[model samples]
Target: MRHAGQRPADMPGAAGFRAAKWHTPIGTSRPSSRVLPSPARVRGPGPAARADRAQGPDRGASVTDLATMSLQQEIARDLQVSASFDAQEEIERRVAFLAGQLTSTGLRSLVLGISGGVDSLTAGRLCQLAVERVRAAGREAEFFAMRLPYGDQADEKDAQQALEFIRPDRVLTVDVKPASDAALQAALAGGTEFRDAHHQDFVHGNIKARQRMIAQYAVAGAHEGLVVGTDHAAEAVSGFFTKFGDGAADVVPLTGLTKRRVRAVAQALGAPSALVLKTPTADLETLNPGRPDEDALGVTYDDIDDFLEGKAVGEAAFEAIARRYRLTEHKRRPPIAP
Candidate 1:
């Protein structure tokens, strides 16, 4: 299954690939496969190496080459590791631990919003599995999956696919548009001087997210269930989620996992391929129609996952990620007290 020029560890050239000392310049063009290095292997030049590189062009070029090669190797290694996991074992352990957390709260059930997206689908499936384990142990547990669409989600079919797979104890559908509209109307009702520009799509999207949480908490209140969230390490790191909106949850089972890991978990849990492979979308604004999550992120999930997994990223990717992580620090923190 190795692609062209990609050798296995036991293959003839792989040893050289691993041990070979690259002597090319920093910006030398390499095959796509070898352009990035394993993060573990990317290390700073030792004192002697740095001294040698400073001596002359030949040594400096070679040092730069080694650094570049290390970066490429690190990235490739991260990618390889990302695709491999102990799916069943991980799933079982996560479910058991999450079930313990849920039961510890004395809640009768777990309620979560299912968008038919991979994150929610994976979290929902994990919750269902946890509830099943709870019941098997003769404890009372149930799962509530809510479908919250702003108006009409184009990807409702994906949600259906997820529901068919997860099959929670109860399914609830609530359109958050009315509340969203009411909030927007109330905000701009006074017709302030800046009313026109104040109510942007992102503003409305935040309202939708908060409204959805309201619906979720409403159901959780009646059923004595805790709200579960789908936020994972990837979104949590980048602060890609809305505050007090999708981010509000009693238990986040999928925390500390990157998006790539989430997908692997979904596949292990038998999520439908269509839902698993579907491009992730926020479904927030109607103006863009189908603005992808990556569009708002300013980077692809692949880059985010790689960066989050500690892979050595390119300069541009690193800067973009760092900027985002820095700016979104507020989103991940509690409000400042006077």
Candidate 2:
């Protein structure tokens, strides 16, 4: 099997979907109309029906209205219950602890791919804290933040923000356009027809992610440092990441936390409020206004994480996630022997 750092000849260009912060659609926590029964009366007529009609349509409608109200109330109650269980504090502590552990591993320095997303931001912060702890102990610790862009100006902007936040020993920017274009041309030459908008998006998005991963690993090797991954539990659970792409990391600081909790940890760590509040985007498309990742994946991160944690995933949702997860589980694991 090809190692995570190696880019295959047929690999497409760097144009993966951008990461964006999530905003739950309006009324997501509320009961939907599907929960309510139809207000229309039954057309069928019979003596038994007529006898049962003593309750009248008004009574039935009233009952349904009450039931609908109760359903909404119940949904609200459940949401509150779920909200109460957010693992923000726990995740933050874990990340902080992980940072200490990494330093104790006798590593000289830390390197990370700073994408300006919550995951990367959280990882960067933890690395900074870890370096500080190591410095306090009279040990040498360094942080390098690399900004790898694939012909995207927005990526430059995000990288700049990350640079300002982390203030690493050195900030490096590598342009992957040459490699990306080569792969894209190869894909076109192979006569791989782009079927629709979705297919095109998928192909392009995977290319960008894989390219970034390749660049990150190359830098890690040159610096003799571990490559930090920004993947979170939500993305991992739904297999939303590209294999050997963003999934390639020497150390994953936030893999155990959900997207929602990741945001909270970022906020708690004094990350820029804007960075915490901004919608997550992978910054793959510099020209086009980026779409939310969940929109592209057709499911919310909250639902994905819930299912991964052994909560109820409906039959349809369960099958969808299960298949994707099984296929992508390889991305989450170390390389196996043949």
Candidate 3:
């Protein structure tokens, strides 16, 4: 008994959606939907296309079209991606914002995990700057740059570099592998087997992420501080974070900026060029360790940044991005209330 002429479960467009293919962009498992041919792929008129539909496709786009697009044209994206800002001004604003958070909440510290990635590294630097500003204002605040690694992370050297750049008040390390592996062992002992090795690796990867966050929260709680996350518009477009793990944060200073914009802020913060431009990756899966984020997304950050920044992108890139944004809406939202 199909409701509303539902297609079979195995069908490409089943479940009321086209079931856009994923290269596991969000650092999670690929969606369960079976392979759908590219040509047969439904080209979702991307954000620009959707926006154009609202006010006659023939009309040229307004300069601020993206910032002011109607709800229907913009529902997929979580934030409006601005083109650029004065890097120093953005930095000062973010530092001041962080300082405000501390002053208003009276929290003694800002705790963030430093993964040696641009996002975390920038946020860590900002956190240090913010705490310093708070202290200058006759208040006490500390920035704790935590290293919650899964045993020995492949990027320890980069992490050290980030630490040197951030110069946080204190640096702490918590090896999350022991705890993460324990959970996996328990699940296996209880007769739980994932679909395959990659599936198991993906699940364990999420465990690692959650454990890392657990460490951050514990440290934050001990010092009466807030957990900071590195989420920004570029990553947000694909929801490229583990839910409740890296995703759950008390504050995100890097919100609404794209990857390139984040790098600009990093430069303003005096980050070394090498660390600022490292290829982004979730680096989660043991099966495909250190997978480049571009590989996972099936699109490049350049394309993502362009689409997010309201520049024209090829149809394929646009569809891939819009699809991820649509699929991962749940990651960005709070739990639904009755």
Candidate 4:
């Protein structure tokens, strides 16, 4: 007779099969072999076992896809665009109402950092509108645009374009080469080595950004005006800015809008097409040139914003962003105490 949990030695389909060893709580023993069911009967067959079948393949998207995806995901998912229209209108109305607030607060002028990009251009134009409103209310309000170049000649071109576009009451260009060089020398003296030209380029870029902030604050103080920030919600959420550098401001005019929305609004306001379409760069260079902002960040601003808005940015995209921004996170927020 067969024992418990043991099959018969001459079981069916066991003529050519060898006995297999079995381990139980009692002891180890060999049991008669049994034929196993086919894989299709056990696990079933439906989809192919391929990476693309399981997780979808990403062969890189087109520019239109990238732009549309970013905007749609951020507005629809994170901000809930349908429910946000009223809130957005209210924010615009409040911005218009700031004319009265400025008057009451004894502020007469607005100082803006005109980077010639969509954000800065939008902020400059919006400030111009607010200044007009304030002036209409019998209050003196002026818009001062400063083009502070850290030695990049290409940036000077963009800055000049912005200056021509805005026609601010006062346009000043301050070269921050001396300050940037001093900072670079100090940083390198601390044993921080540059792996290549790109690394050195980034260090110089950070200097340029900080120098521009210093110049903006100085101009704002001199003119006794509120320093307007050009930072938008997308950059804020992903921490894509310099902390006390470009991130510092008295008031951020475009803080509620994403970078994509900023471009839309800028286009709506009739900003220069060339300036609006230009790839953003920190404009830090004394000699050759540097890579664009997207190149340094590994991912585009649109992609970063989309991920922040709760869209599936994919593991590869996320890793690219993490690798880039993780190292520069300190530039995005206030220094924490150890």
Total clashing residue pairs per candidate? 12, 16, 0, 0
Each model's lDDT comes to 0.61, 0.53, 0.67, 0.53
Worst 10 residues of 3 by lDDT: 1-10
Those runs of model 3 whose alpha carbons end farther than 4 Å from true positions after fitting are 1-78
TM-score of each: 0.74, 0.65, 0.79, 0.65
As for lDDT, the candidate ahead, 1 or 4, is 1
* Sliding window of 10 residues with minimal summed lDDT for model 4: 1-10
Q: Please write out the lDDT profile of model 4 over residues 203-268, one tens digit for every residue.
A: 466566677778888887887787776655555433445444665666666644656666777777
**What is the Cα-based TM-score of model 4?**
0.65
Question: Which is the winner by TM-score between candidate 1 and candidate 4?
Answer: 1
Candidate with the greatest TM-score versus the true structure: 3
Worst 10 residues of 1 by lDDT: 1-10
lDDT of 4: 0.53
Candidate with maximal lDDT? 3
lDDT tens per residue, model 1, 73-189 = 343342233344577877987798778876787778988898878989998999898999888988899998898887888877878888999989999899999999998788778
Higher-scoring candidate on TM-score, 2 or 3: 3
Clashing pairs in 3: none
